[model samples]
Target: MNSPGVKIHHLDGIKILDLFAGPGGLDVAAHFLGFKSIGIEWDRNACETRYAAGLPTIHADVSVMRESRFAEIPSTVDVLAGGPPCQSFSVAGNGKGRRALETVKKFIHRLVDGEDEARIDEDLRALDDPRTALVLEPLRWLLKAIDTEGRDPYKVIVLEQVPAALPLWEVYAKLLRGGEGRLKGVKYEAECWQLKTEQFGVPQTRTRAVLVARRPGHGAIAPLKATHFPFDLHRGKRNVAQAEMFPAEPATPGGKQRWLSMAEALESASSLENSPVDVSRLRRNGRMEFFVVSNYGSGGDPKNRGQRLSSEPAFTVTGKVSRNKVYKSMAEYEADTSERFTIHESGVLQTFPHNFPWSGNDQAQQVGNAVPPRLGMHVLSWALRGSPPSDDELVAAATWPNTPRTTTAELRDIGCGDQSQCPPGSHKVTRSRRKPAP
Candidate 1:
């Protein structure tokens, strides 16, 4: 792909504040897009990761922080972006969703109140236990506060969440547009878009709902266009030569289809490292026994490696990956043991460049929960570019860097500290030692 002339400083000196800045995914993208950014996150580990990446961050609960405190932030932040926690809205969380919505509402109220301690506290108490409505509520208040101060500090507010939050978009839309919500005077119109991560160059097929709002007077900016190929065999436009697909049109106004495959998302690169398992040990372990002699593809032999599907994008990454199971074809599985997606690999899939360090589990839940950094980068690019690029322009943009291949032996020998630790039974091999000279 050729580099486009679009510059990162689309807004030229705009400032951004990211809430719920998990591991700096959005913040890193924002910086690359040329916005001066400050991230607010409550998780210590996430904060550390952000800090280590050299991104400025504020560690605090959005619920407790007063709106006046936001004044402590720049008076003219050009953009406010974040994805509030969506557990309450999730099907697993059930009816508690209302309470969660309320928590978001309260948080918006406080932000609008300019951090009035009394009001903030009252809003907090108003929320029922096991509820988190305070989260979205304060942002409502913050938006209004920004407007009332006569500084159109935030040109855009991007709210990203799981599909369950679709219903709440109208609620936020109303609140921002100065309708039936407590946040008055913050008149804005919102455009909602849903995207599968693969559509944005992420290997995983994770889908997220995004709401983009701008103050009423600003000329309308269309919803962001998808940049990655869709998983569907039939739908949208197809690139016959590249063999890329686009997402199908939404079945309903707000619904979308499944994700993409791994091979389709990544470009081919030489294998840099290998971490072969002890076949005997794997056979002994019931969990991995099947993999010992499993066929990965048309390449039937257990000894010969299989190949990854280069034409398709990857499956959604998760934290609960089983040692023996495979997401792609068996032939693809035999190609490389490390090819079974790891957390680091998943991170890369999310568009987090190699430089961003992640700490914690190497499992499915963690991987699945992460926002694809590439998607984040794309959003940041939109915010920075001020205008959306044409479909042709977006397609012409650069894909992420390829993963450098290396052998586990080479990695360990070079002392690359962040290298994936060897799995069970693969003790570090050492040359025989000579008898000590007497």
Candidate 2:
């Protein structure tokens, strides 16, 4: 496929504040959609990567920023976006956040009730895992923006987390839509849904719970529509139970496309060979087919490791993605472990550019944790424009960085520490007082 060579759209005067913005996944999409964005992140490692990529970033703990430094943030934020840390709620991790769901909901109510910050923090500290409380930070920022004098409420809010956080997002949707308590006079159209990444053309089967809220005036917010058919692990054939749960829908021209497969996303695949009848077959596209052997196993059985064909979307890319091995054939798997997916390939599977400048330690972790930029493009288009992104915009996202656009000099550093220690070409981004066109 050739580069789309589409120009980046800059929605003048519209800005985004991204909290816990790891490695600029959503920010990249926001830039593709023509919105300026500043990501607030606490991880020194992720910040290093963000800086290397020329993604504007503020390196600070969000919890600390909330206490005494929210004033440092730029005042004209139309969008609030983030995916708070999800280790506590992730199915792969300890279920501390899952168990504390009721507790977190009560905390939201407390925030709605106008509870003191110190009091809320004190209670949040008592939770089994404090990271669970971080989920509420978006609400805090939203309410503060609404209630603060001289500050307009955010025109829109976008948030995403592991699927387990859907219930929490539903709570946010309810409060935003219902206008309860401090939200009483506020007007927002809100929707929350579980987004399957593969349906949006991400070459992985990750699922995320997303919330998009905007002032009613923008347009009635609609559930993000899928642009591709869902992937079936069974490939072309499905057993009775699978058939019932996931009905097949073939791809058609000018309609939804088939879920993108790993072999299609990565160009480094070895030559194809028909494996055993039990092994999944490659799609008719005739690309070099491969399969993956996960380090981890299904049903917690180490002996029964999970496996997937390159013709299918990959299993959810996790922080330990580097440990998963890829093989061109069953013979290759039996002989010895083949090479693992590179960090760049993993990022591509997550719908980031093949040439995305990744830096810092735990690079795999950064790619694994990112909100798929293509998925973000869909959600952001729905939130801001109340429709799916145009084909040109989609092509732009896919063919990002046809040429480097944002130079380090153009970025306005916000809340970054020690200008003397800052990287070369660092500068401040200032905005005009004029509001964006509605």
Best by TM-score: 2
**Residue-level lDDT tens digits of model 1 in 57-175:** 55565543334345445554767788777566654345466546645554654555468656666756655544455345436535455556555646677778777676566556656
Candidate 2 per-residue lDDT, tens place, 132-183, comes to: 9999999988887777778888989999999999999988888888887877
**Lowest summed lDDT window (length 10), candidate 1:** 1-10
Listed in order, each prediction's TM-score against the native is: 0.61, 0.82
- What does candidate 1 score on TM? 0.61
| Highest-scoring model, lDDT | 2
Candidate 2 regions with alpha-carbon error over 4 angstroms: 1-14, 235-254, 268-287, 297-302, 399-415, 419-438
Q: Itemize residue pairs with steric clashes in candidate 2.
A: 9-34, 412-428, 412-429
RMSD of each: 12.5, 10.6
Return the TM-score for candidate 2, rounded to 2 decimals.
Answer: 0.82
Off by over 4 Å in 1: 1-14, 92-95, 98-131, 134-138, 141-144, 147-153, 179-184, 233-260, 264-311, 318-340, 360-367, 383-386, 389-438
